[model samples]
Target: MEQFYTDERNVQILIALLKEHGIKKVVASPGSTNVTFVGSIQQDSFFEIYSSVDERSAAYIACGLAAESGESVALSCTGATASRNYYPALTEAFYRKLPILAITSTQDESKIGHMIPQIIDRTVQPLDTVKCSVHLQTVKDAADAWDCNVKANKAILELTHGGNGPVHVNLTTTYSRNFMVKELKRERKIERVMTYGKFPDIPKGKIAVYIGSHVRMSKSLAESIDLFCETHNAIVAVDPTANYTGRYRVPYMLVAQQSIEDENRNPDLLIHIGEMSDMAGIVGQPKSVWRVNEDGKIVDRFQTLRYVFEMPEHLFFEHYSKSLLSRQNTYYNSCMEKCNYFWNNIPELPFSHIWVAFRLHNLLPMGSVLHLGILSPLRSWGYFPIPSHIEVYCNQGGFGIDGNMSSLLGASLVHPEKLYFGVVGDLSFFYDMNVLGNRHVGENVRILLINNALAAEFHLFKQTNLTKVNEIERFLSAGGHFGCKSLDVVKHLVEDWGYEYLTASTKEDFEKVYERFITPDLTEKPMIFEVFTDVNDENEALRRMYFIESSTRYKVKNAVKNIIGEDRMEIIKKIIKR
Candidate 1:
């Protein structure tokens, strides 16, 4: 008997669903089983595919891209060993709340217990780490496979649409290429629009817009919020990549919250966006507060007097601006006025790192993507204003430099046509230097290394005590061959490694070098810009920064404490006091 329906449509259904969801990026590893689905995806020009030779990097690259974009990104690999390769990234993504969709090939269900070559507990291997795992059986079992696909897609959307996190989808080969295209098309639901409820009355004056570590929200939202702030004369302090300061145009950020208290400015309202963990300790308690969260969950880190877990900030501001009345206050303006004075009186140092970031922000191509490493480079980006449209990514959720080059390479793979920049420290670049060899990465990606010639962060410790210099020098031995930093070695990297290198010794040199690097010949492959600085001067700047932020010194101390974690608080206490 000839069957009227076929299972071949399932893959189309799932891929079509992904396309409908605006998931334009996919990271894939070479595998035999996923050939059909990959072929289909390739045929469709809607989604871009980044092929990674290493499955582990493939998964983390997907994690990094989605984390940066605040959306769901997919990674595909074969079953068994290939699936196992994604575990580390899966755990990290789960904990960090990055939305990573993964697909793995599988053996037929009939061979489940027959000791098949690539068979393991596929359904349960990452059960503990993933939000949900669906065993997509077969296209003939449309009731089962499509359900899993829809559920997996929904989980990703829910994870990211809320606070931006990761989720896993375990797709089996038997179901990958099968779907009842007609039926699935009738039920497809894509693109969810977030809406927010009304926030409480704003204080007539003294409102502060404090931006935390965040990505997402439309440009229209920023403009509306700016208008509201302008109308109310609110003090807007933005964290890195918030695009908050650009609209305000004043030095609208404080390096430390102690600065706010030092200036004797307390606020009636503390409207916060994104993660508050970093700023929670400093902002202290607010008299009244409101938070806009995508997931509708309330987090009272400061135990503020009031709470509102509205939808995305953009939706909230859009609604508020239409109905809410503006209230101007003197205290808010006074607080901002002092912030203005601080900016005007910024100490004339030899050269500040923020100046470097400010210059790069302009030099980088407009509408480009920047993958900023989590250490000094990320901190500098906080003070510098970025173009509102230029997408920025960092490993701030669980900051690490171990995979700096690989992660950016993966991101570049997904969007090969767009200009991509990897902003990393010398230490970070050395850690993952091999990623530079990934043939998948080409002219689209650039490596911008801020080479201060030593561990920039450790330089701060050298200032605390001259004895720490010896300790700092020890790190140099373990991180890279000393030859890598020698002038000869750097030249070898440019001439032999096939990377176009540019070095900067002075502030003026850096500005000119950066301008040229930013305006690259897009027709050619990506280039690397290695900006060199003096190790001694870098340390001096950090020491001065610490002194300027002594009241908030506990922030750095807490980071050190986290090394031992809560279990060894007693040990951390002794070290802090020492």
Candidate 2:
């Protein structure tokens, strides 16, 4: 099918394989060793190639493309330190379960370990962060390079498929230039199979669906489910695990289980799609559970969990919506009335979780990709309901906060039109401040920094004799602490780097600053909104979010108790209350 240079056959074979597998984009930075690979791709018209001078930014841009398309994208760099520059993006791709194939062209084997220029161990450099790491032993022989290409392409597919991550492939310049290409075809027709199995031919009553994080359930699918559920008067329950809320007119799942004593409101058939639900306990026990998964395999994480594995959620929805039970409408009004009664009673106040969510959700522009930093802000955002158009992305694969700025920035680079909004805590933002270095950052990138001044997530953990100090002091003493006192780093980012900067010190400031921040007008340069709050205050505010006073009410209490102990909870309470 498609062809490249015959002399440098390995590069051509690899390119053909990649193109065969539906890879149509490549991001690259100019490097000598990877010249042949880059050259071959340059002349080829099948794939679009973007050139970024900085390898780090280029890798991140590639990541953005992969994240946007949910497909495998490639990044290339020459061997040694130049290739190693892709570390941040590789780590990000690994953690985010993104499919980004990084090809590093290394120096010849003879040039190894002799203090050669740009000749570091490319194979071992990104081992920890990449799903697969392969070093082509020899490329002079056609078989060796061909085998490398085949193996690398397979690894790329494996890393990307089944909702996994990225892979790394390293090759020497000799292999790139000297390898021979045999006759190979490059056409793959991928057919999506939709399957539906028979459910028990019984009347299904109140039905509920729960979706989890990192699962790629699109807005259309969610809306369809919402419509079907509403039409059938089915008791639908979508948790934060679904990563979608407020799409429906009525409240779906009771996050805190405030009040639902009615018998008809409970779920009869629970339809769970995507990942596992974060919330374990819920309103009413289910009669039977049916799991509609795209992956096909019935992976029972919970030993006692009951379900039937189905294929292609859309087909399942299409068939089920038109089923015999379509005419039924249960006590949906009564259930809604009950839910409304409780939700209306929920006090809307300043600094509350719902209040904050409402405020930010309203403040943020529609169609913004919310880049959530791990820990409190992420949990708060999860609990805080947002609008439908806002797409949420976080490094949940590894759950690491080391590269939030870099990851979002990378995504922003690729998608310049979308508002790349980030909600990150102080510590996490500071951890990856190096990402702010003069790199390619597109306009419309807004980072909302929810600064609590410390690692508030760990503030609830019990402090023994080993650690007995205030949260700030404890954080300062930690080896990996990255909290900045003077806001000098942020100032540098704003004033020196020419980033549109906005800072908020209080709730009033937050409201005022946010009002102007999310404008409908498109602007160049990324913006950062650094909203400051005390750790204890944030904790108390978030705790009161759920209206119900049960285990969740005492969760914050216990967390504080663990962090400051029982003796200090009273003091901390007094300070927060004041």
* Model 2 lDDT tens row, 1-578: 54445455456567677776677789988877888788777766787889899999988998899888877788888876777678898898888888888888876767778998777765465455787676654556756754665465455555645566778887656634433344344422122223533444324577666554545466677666766665566654544435554334233444434432345434666666666444434435665556667774433332223444447676666656664345444555655655555444445454533355557764577777777776565566654445656677777657777888888888787767777877777777777776766467777677777665566655533324423455445545332344344555576666577688888766777777777678866676667777766655655554455445434444566666778887787787699998
* lDDT of candidate 2 at residue 237, scale 0 to 100: 52
Give all candidates' CA lDDT scores.
0.63, 0.63
The CA-based lDDT of model 2 is what? 0.63
> Residue 132: error of model 1 in Å?
17
What is every candidate's alpha-carbon RMSD to the true fold?
Answer: 18.7, 18.9
Give a tens-digit lDDT track for model 1, residues 1-578. 22122244555556766766677799988876776567667656677888897999998898878877776788888766888888899888878877777777666657767888877666565554566555555566646654655554465455555555555555556533332233324334423334533345566645666766666556677787777665666656655544453355333444343232343234677777776324343344566667667764434444452444546676665555664445554545565565555444444445545556745665677778888887677666654446666777776666777887787888888867788888888777777887776667777888787776566665555346643557556664243454546655655755466677777768887767676678745746568777766666665655554344332345665676668776688775689899
Q: Count of backbone clashes for each model?
A: 12, 8
